[model samples]
Target chain A: MSLTRRELLKFSSIAAVALAATGCSLTEPTSENPESMGSVGMGTPAELAETDAPKVVIVGGGWSGLSIAKYTKKFAPNAEVILVEQRTEFMSCPLSNLWVVDAIKLEFLMHDYLQASRENNYTFFNATVVGVDKTQKIISTSDGDIAYDYLVLAPGIDYDYSEWTSDPVLERRLRTEYPAGFKPGSEHISLRNKVLDFEEGNFILTVPSGNYRCLPAPYERACLIADYFKKEGIEGKVILLDENPNITIKQDGFRSAFEKLYGDYIEYLPGSKIINFDLDNKKVETEFGEIIEFADAAFYPKVRGSKLLEIAGVAKDSRFNKMEADINVFTYEVNGYPEIYCTGDARPMGFSKSGNTANTEGVYVAKQIAAKINGKKEMPAWESPLTICFSAVAMEPILAISINAGYAYDEKQKAFGFTDVYANEKWDGRVGKNNGKGLMEWAKGMYRDMFNA
Target chain B: MKRRSFLKVVSATGMMIAINPSMINQVLRADDGRLYKSYARVQLLNAEGTPMTEQMLETSENYVFNYPYEGTTTLLINLPNESAKDVSLKDEFGEAYLWKGGVGSRRTIVAYSGICPHQLTHINKKDSFITYRKKGERFEGHVVCDGHTSVYDPEHGCKVMKGKAPQPMASIVLEVGDDNTLYAVGVLGPDKYHEFFKSFRRELKEQFGSKRNAKKEVVSTAVAMRLSAYTQEVIQL
Candidate 1:
């Protein structure tokens, strides 16, 4: 069951094209004995419902990966698209703030990856990627190694607690006890419990700096949790400790909501960076010598590209983040590795790391992959990824605000800039129930597009 | 074997197991200039139950009707100018098809599926985010979906004018009867009917009593009404 690195490398040297013809495989032959190195390398090859068609192995099943899986097969019908995700089922990160406060049911954010695969004509493989052999075009997963004609790596962001503390013990405690619920599943459940169980005390939440996942989420979470406290008549207050200078996006709407609606239940502190955390005493020290005591906390730290990028040897530190995919910014391909793409939040682009942006970018990447597979000389014209973000500002009526824009590449700056910007940061003053409806509709349409639900 | 020919066979025979539910939009322009099979011959009528003629339809009014299917919504508008002739259109999956211009004396009367081809954002009962924009509007003269800001040119076969809609809105073919009554006979180019049905089962059930009833193909007559009248809220962004 164990594989040495040399053995795995040896197995990858077999010409992938001659695998079916020469009857060569990574799968171990039938063996009655459980242990004895029946195979030269790792576990047997994954028993997939596969074909001789061009294999497109996409790792990650988030917004970007799902869209790429669905459209790549649609554009190139003969390509066998297999999406590898670690999670058993999909729980949407967007609109999860509403779910945390019980505004929407858990089922609202839950979707079946199996259904998506069936309808979209793709295979959903539930496995975590351990490493990727760039030379042999083989992805080493927890289950087995999968060969790909075209490989896409879209592992999302991973929280960076290094800035706060370098100690592994403190990092483990922070990760487990005060789970940043920004990720999907169990962390959200923990944060929800913290909100429901609070009697009357200061509940702490932190916002990180840089281009984080869902720029407006931390603010939205603060607002919704505060709204819940206000609605329940709890004497609790949300002490929002933001490392950033100010609210990141939809500032007008969130600021107004904080002042107008949850003024008493929420306290907005901008540059209060936590220098020391006394987890045992429920106290934290700010950078400017300010001592604050909290009943509970969910410490969100700065983020970087997922660790998988570094393991694959395709990672480079970007201006804003670390260990991001070292790929061509325009084409999204590894510098020397042709046909291997890295997308989604793992990308080093300064574009707002959100679901809509990733989904749109996924479609563009899918088209390019399809064009190559179909033997088209010219790649399709590059299109901008749309950033359509909706942030909830209030509950009861669930009023909200939104922003819609597309990105354009700048030659001089060597970066992407937002274009066709339309901002509607008007809530509680000139907004109605329609904006809330828009928020739900936007999520619904995005889910439908990705899952074919 | 070329990929196009192989795909043609796979699609025509409906033999592809994975993509069977939505067989790639078959591009068929028969002898009569029809791109798809003729569906229910639903006669467009006003809210008063009177047959709606091309001349009777007014410009700037957001007229809507459901044809071909019970739950599907189609846009019926009288454009201020003539629609372009024989516009080459591509579907979301890059299938090529042609859309003949509006079928009337002035060629100003046109119909397109109310469903936004980008993401299936359609005109619904609670909110109608997609509609034809008239003069004095931000996206004036183009059919705009405010949900994602995809604009379509109603006068030129609903080609994407701005924003990120992959294809033009699916065209709805109409014919003016000898007596001047308008009738929707078939859908032009490619559409999102299969995806629409699969995606909106919940909404369809709540709106139409059951999802099965929502998918029943339309029969002889369907009531054509105003976009505002069809939905309670038309939040113009």
Candidate 2:
């Protein structure tokens, strides 16, 4: 499709949102045509067997996109579902921290969208989404055009390196020089190589502000990297520069591990919010007035919804799309586009953009999409998603934490109070292995539900 | 019987995929070109080229395979000594991988990882040989992953017997330096072992054919009986 740069950015942003809607995973592969192109729909063939299948177009086959596709296939199996993703396979950002430590390979962390969505029985377009016209309910991709009854936006976050650091080359150098390895691919490999090469040097980790993917990830990264250094007889310290006062999730557990086992090797500089960086000097000047220099640095920059969400007029003050504060869930049909839904990291929910959270949101949204298509009146009672994260302490004694948040009306105070559900514990090593197995099964089951089921 | 028959059955009783030593040199070549080449010239580093720990050397002496969950490679370990006993590790499905005796003269027991070639399921040990089945057959007497029927040759470098799996069981190199102490030289794989022979294909076709022809019938007849025994233990959660 011939799309203008502006339209491309807009569509790319929406595609990002659609991708995140599926939790950064592509839809199941369609066996007939290897290039299973298009977006997620409300139903496949079987679910829409009785009712006329709604033509749902999902852009970007990442987590959020795949989730919407999965649920849609389940409840409305007869719906004409279309998923469009640029990548052939989906690589997870959840366990990516292990890739930085050479514990897991990138291939091991990736899933074939085509193979997974084979039985999904949808038109799969292995092409980049370019533009979407909500008025016409039509989305255009690199390959062709698709019409949709319901549009799901979840393209996932883009590295607005421009927002944090202006220089893409410098950003490239930061990864090349110090090995930040924030995003994926070579960056991860470089970071791993840098870590293995380092016998002893100051390793600095900085977490940028605003909501980002896997809030606890940077801390976990720091812990794993630190463990690697310690094992290698490296005489160094991992200095953490928090853009905020403290991390949002399991901050205490990370701090305890740092202090207890790696007391001599680790240091945390709270409120060391990095304003910008001078890549040449290898220095990041923070808002808290600390100019820190390091032998190596890993930066986790701030996150925002895909640019399409903003162009669609769904994004709020910051780049993130605003969620309805009443429920704190990021599921809404835009005023102009009533048939479309936005969720996940792309949706402006004041929550950590995590795999578990996004997965739960995807399931919830799927159920919602099913209800809407079935002509149900009342929207299902929206329950807050439970958040669970596994953080390995040197690939041993993996820690697990479950988190949930909800709204409750305080009649006595005539106001609203938050019912926060949070639990943290050290998962037994064997249990953690079992959890890994369980998660693998869940992925397989989820893949089946998206395609076969 | 011909000399080949005595050699055939006994040899068939234990299978090992011969690996080339140069593959290890290549991976280490990236780490430190000089050190790897130096070791390659000496050919002292065994299969994996990963430095062996004292614990691994000791374990290799008694058992051919030790499931060390803590190590980088979790499957088979090869011992350098020839006197070590042949043993098998089985999974819940009764699939097995053999941990054949010592690879060298150091009396060092080497254990290779028993993870299947397809999915990374740990190979189970049962009786004298670790055997894995697919659908119902003994998976042609090869190590088959329960998740997907990817096969492996444990005696060798855990080479893939069949299916889409490319990599082999990384051989844990067993070495005894001048100090008379056993050490894991390195891990062995196609990338590490393909240099020694003009790619033998590990004779997987013969191995698979022999096992399949010898026993064509399904063995899950016993597996169904085990499932019923477990049903009584469940209280309906």
Candidate 3:
């Protein structure tokens, strides 16, 4: 499904005529359809009836959706921006390792979207998006169907536990009982409390191979938990089973931290695949015919684009099942639908699936939409997204190691390539102490930029 | 000069003073003190308690003196006339101090918690984490967290004017001594230990009665620094 330049131009002409007939211009606020007026929260019906402005509907309120909402409202104040997120409060997956180890309180990680909505002058609907009707340019939500000139899908990721366990009963137990705490909320908190309570016993943490959100996070969790064990003087061992051949990212720092800090407490095994889980016995059987028993366990199952993507008819037939976005790279528009864009973790790009990348891409997509709406020619080339990842190595002294990478958009390849990449340098005690502090400072700025400003 | 231009001058001066402390004396000595006196009432001081004279402020534009006291750091900006000022409240510190507008010779002097309200990370002038903005004719100062850009306005008790901050930036109440030195007597709003201890001390005194000889114990600067550092680490984590 690819949109050619000629087809895009033809569509634009048809859209312009349609928009003119529907009175979706800067002069009028009210759309031709009175039904949409009741469903969409642009403003009071009276106020909205006065001016016809373009409407941008953003689904999901994580890093990407929030950023799009902010930037769209910023660039086009007259545009009616509606953000649809199911969750009432924003929870960050980045730096959640601190929360898991009980180093930080949950309150610090949660944020309300009210400020973002109010400050940006956008309407925020706490409603789940059910389906995207691209033909009608309307999205069906739990609240109602809302019309949109441009639709942005940032529904995040969902776990694919089918390969691991086919039995529905076992899968439900795996999700609820053993649990993977990747997604922020009650499950994360439960895992944290469980780890804290576990005394002298085998606690197993497994990491899935391939692309996952926050690549260094699983290792960071292991290090932080090991640090917790050392701090409480607990007699226990943490078995770290990795499906990947080796540490995926920030390898030097994590590898060194494991070797030097948690040499005795953590056992790292690579290329170990968990074929099946014996829920009755609390044990997992690896493909190598080795069965590992655990008192407490967390298994990160393979991930795919949220099921909503499949319903939207944008998901690719791949293992990870990401959205099939056009190769423009600058504009993350879906191949056949110029009015629709897919961003964040759901979109298949050359970049790693992380919060920072999602944020950068969200802003880029917003700008691209603005440019198109304003009828600007020659869209600017996208800059490479900056990536900064920090891993907490020790809790007592409160130490952390960091990786900083800056990317540049390659004109020839039409993809982002790393301009500068620094993995693990020697751990500086000062940076380690300061990075923990830096993470919060950085997160606050990011949240403000995305949601508030 | 217009308040915005004056602030630009002050910001430049602050950058110079940051590079060289001795430049403080030179800048202060060169200033006429009229504009400085009109814009800022209190003398900006370092953590070590050196009075940042008007000349130093006049010479440099971005003169932000980092003052570390009682385990936490406070950023003292010479609030320009264009900076947001509120004169609604009156306290025991006198009508002048209570209100944001200057009382007598002292101009409106305000200090904010160096730690960001959202995540307890330290906000500093060097990093541009905390900045003063002159939007058109309206003047405002905001603390910007790099992590999430949560902006807090200093005028309305450091309330979150923009961003993801849940609460206002903690404000440090200041008093000018007879000799024109600024003294931090109390803190109001967010951050943990300072607010906790301040309220705890007040409650204890109220319960024990005034005559119980509840002498205010001055915490050593080292202990305060340690506590501030510890608090920042814990809150951020």
TM-score of B-chain for each predicted structure, in order: 0.84, 0.34, 0.46
Give the interface RMSD of each candidate. 1.4, 13.3, 8.6
Q: Across residues B1-237, which tens digit of lDDT does each residue of candidate 2 receive?
A: 111111111122333333333343332322311111112112122234443334433322212222112111223333332433343432221223333444545433443544333233332221112232223344442344433234565444345665334355444544444554343433333222211111112232243344323223221111101111212221100
lDDT tens digits by residue: candidate 2, A81-123: 7777777767666677777777665665667677646645566
Candidate 1's error at A69, in angstroms?
A: 1.0
DockQ of each: 0.51, 0.02, 0.10
For A56-142, candidate 3 gives per-residue lDDT tens digits of 889989988998888877766778788998899888888788878888878768887987898678888888776554665666566
Clashing residue pairs in candidate 1 (N, C-alpha, C atoms within 3 angstroms): none
Better of 1 and 3 by TM-score: 1
Residues A194-216 of candidate 1: C-alpha lDDT, one tens digit per residue: 88888889999999887778889
What are the lDDT scores of the predictions, listed in order? Answer: 0.81, 0.50, 0.60
TM-score, one value per model: 0.89, 0.55, 0.64
Candidate 2 lDDT at B45 equals 24
The TM-scores of chain A alone, one per candidate, are 0.91, 0.76, 0.85
Give the clash count for model 1.
0
Q: Which of the numbered candidates is closest to the native, going by highest lDDT? A: 1
lDDT digits (tens) for residues B1-237 of candidate 1:
112211231233323221211222333233332234456567888899998887778886888888778899898899988888767766665555666788788889999998998888998777788888889987889999877778999888899988778888877878777788988887765678888888888889999999889888887788888888999888666
Q: How many residue pairs clash per model? A: 0, 107, 38
